[model samples]
Target: MGANDIFGVPGDYNLQFLDHITHRQDLKWTGNANELNASYMADGYAREKGFAAFVTTFGVGELSAINGLAGSIAEHVPVLEIVGAPTNNVQNNGSLVHHTFGDHKFDRFEKAHRQLGIKSARLDGEHAIDQINDVAQYIYETKKPAYIILPTNLVEMEVNKSLKDSIPNLFFNKEMNSENSFEQIKSSINNIENPVIVMGHEVDRFNVFNDIKSFSSNNNIPVLDLGLGKGNIDESFSNFVGTYNGQISDESVNKYVANADTVVLIGAKLTDSVTGGFTQQFNEQNTIVLNYENANIYGKSVDKDYNFKTIMTYLSKTKLDLSLPSIKNADNVSEIKPSNNKLTQSFYDKAISQFTSADNTIVAEQGTSFFGLASQKLPKGAKFFGQPLWGSIGYAFPAALGNQIANKNRRIVLSTGEGSLQLTIQELGLAFREKLNPVMFVIDNSGYTVERVIHGMNEPYNDVPNLNYKLMPKAFGAKEDEYDFIEASTENELFDAIFKAKEEKDKLVLIQVNMEMKDVPEQLAKTAKAFADQNK
Candidate 1:
């Protein structure tokens, strides 16, 4: 509801609504390349900001956007999906629309949305305002995607303003009676000798990111952020430990976490990707989970449901033995020297670590870009976003575009592969047209290296077409002073690109880094081997 900008694509059905958007002086419209990328941009905007609005035409456009909306809801992001449908007369007469199937099924698309667990409502002139308020409240309560079907005829529907607007806001918004839940957590945690906190994604979604930092630092609890919640906490904190992704984590981290007497899992998702194919050693009996729907206090159920922020606030005040056994620091990972002749995944990983800082917000694609940078130690205030669970490629770049709009002060660093970039390369024009400055790295590894690492080495299915990436800037209509492009195949050239990108802060710098097709990051290699083993 607090959207300053809306991301969308115009279609025949949505033309009238686009006209309204064009006249709005308070809001800016971000016309994306397609509906899917538009949805992805909205998802990223919601992740950076509190809420987001995405518009698309019904049927074709809405179906195209389903995947991105599904990812947002799976990751617990609040996005208001607005669909411009046909006129009420057409829908009522069961007229087959141009975007729909040949059969007279007007509700098929909305039915598809329901399968993805999205709450949806179709509006009419009589109940337009009521439906809008209800859906808005639902999105506010649950950090998930909500759907609104606005018929073309109802776009100009006249309705009385809400009488409830005159009333105070506090009467409508009330927190649950978490006093008993707080007492339960406080009592159960007092007996804990060695407590370990595992930061999860919901912490940021609830706007209580600083609360976890306060709780961890005040109680001297060693923090291990999961892969889904990467950059959720300050990596430079004294109490901060490395990311714990089951067997893929460092030996010291696995050992320390295994030896912990009590594990506090706050808003964490122990999914396959986050837990390295469910390799986590900890059991439910010794784990304390604090989430929105599920908040179990070490196998003991609370009186009722408690939110993450409230649970964390109470857990921080509980007494625990802060002076526990000393935790061992992980061994240093050797950085590849930039003096090397060729650029390797390990060197790129090191370069990513070097390029990161407090002023940066890094978005890595789901392939090698994510695997290589997942384990890197970010600066104290740097933010990271990826689609680990969704595993969607081509999501980072457009998402970075929306993120830049949300916070213009922070620099957005985008790392993506060539194969993935080809999916939404048209959106590159939107970034250039908006005059946004994002340092984008397009890795040209010849093909889908991540898929090859898993299976089918040398298969043609994984190969991608190669093109001169340097010409991309001019193709996107970028002006000479507004953009720069570099192709880096060697270590020296890569460093040159990085230095120039950082130096030219106002220009949108795109660096194309070439590597061997067989090359893979250390973390990705091991994980892929295990995946290949399962298929065998």
Candidate 2:
């Protein structure tokens, strides 16, 4: 509901609808290179703004954006996907459109989207407003993606003044305990001596960060988080422990969570990647899980599908007598010293840790960047996100672009592998066109380093073409004064690039960090081995 700008591409069917979107003074349209890139940008925008929207044409355009919407669905991000459909006349008559197959099946695309667990409705002029409201309400409640197919005839549909009144009533109604009903888990947890709070990505999607943070602080609880939702809580908080991903977690952090008598797991998803290939074994009897659909309290379960904020508000107010065990809450930052030696993976991790700060919004890609900085502590007020479940390649680049668009004042920083960057590298041109400046750390490790860690160390399929990443900005039409490129092959050179980037506030800095193709972070190597074991 809070989307002020929409990212999309134009096609023949949606050209008419595009005019109205373009004329709206409240919205700015960013025309991307492709629909997939547009959808990725929308996903990024929603990560920052809590709600995002993107437009695409009926069949061809919509299909291209479906993967990005699927990421929104799996990660619990709220994104509104507006599709421009062929005229109702064509739909009613079963006539073939230019974008459709010759068989004249216009409903194929929406049906395909239904398989991805999203709410979709093709709109006609009569019930368009009502349908939009229904789909939007579901998206907000579920914190997932929804599709609204708008026909060409409805682009400029004339309505009465009564319909204008409906605009102000767009907010979801919330009472003290209506949408979210909670019964106290008071007696179950009263005897708990050691309690730990483990958070996940849902805290970001439902906008419940403040309530959870306050609850953890007031109760004097140690907080551990999964890697998917890294920046939802302030790592600088006194009670914060390091990130926990099953056995891959820092030994002390994992041990603390394992030894806790009461574990409060808030919206944490135990997917294969986050759980170290289902290696996490929790004591269900001592755990209290508060998630999107239901609550599991100390071996007792609630059937009510509750929202995160209200449930958290109820939990924060409940009194619990918890005598916490002595736990060490320290940052998982790599402090590898700079030297004349070549940049190894450990030094790369350290360089990234120093490059990030409270002033930056960091978007780390799934493979190297995300796993490399999994437990790297951030300065307070820094925002971080990556696609863990969806695991799409080249997502962070365009998403960073969209994030910067949503919050123009924040400095956008990106850490991505070279192989993934090649997929959406064209978005850099669009960012330059929009007059956006972002600092990018391109991991030039020669090929797909992550895939090599998983199974194939020397497979030809995992190898990528050789290309110089330094010339990207100039080739993308960034003016000489608008951009700078730095190569960080040695440890000293790596730190030099980070310091130089801090000084140049107005220009885009692209750092080509050279490392061995086979080298990877220790955590990622272990996680990949666990994943490989599970597959066998």
User: For this target, which candidate reaches the highest TM-score against the unseen true structure?
Assistant: 2
Model 2 residue 114 distance off true place after TM-score fit, in angstroms? 1.1
User: Which segments of candidate 2 are over 4 A away from where they belong?
Assistant: 176-181, 281-283, 303-307, 325-336
Cα error of candidate 2 at position 238, Å: 0.9
Cα-based lDDT at residue 109, candidate 2? 91
Tens digit per residue, CA lDDT, model 2, 184-279: 454555667877888999887787767777777666778888888888878787778777888777787788777887888888887878777766
lDDT of each: 0.83, 0.83
Whole-structure CA lDDT of model 2: 0.83
Q: What residue pairs clash in candidate 1, if any at all?
A: none
TM-score for all models, in order of appearance: 0.95, 0.96
Each prediction's total of clashing residue pairs, residues at least 3 apart in sequence or on different chains, is 0, 0
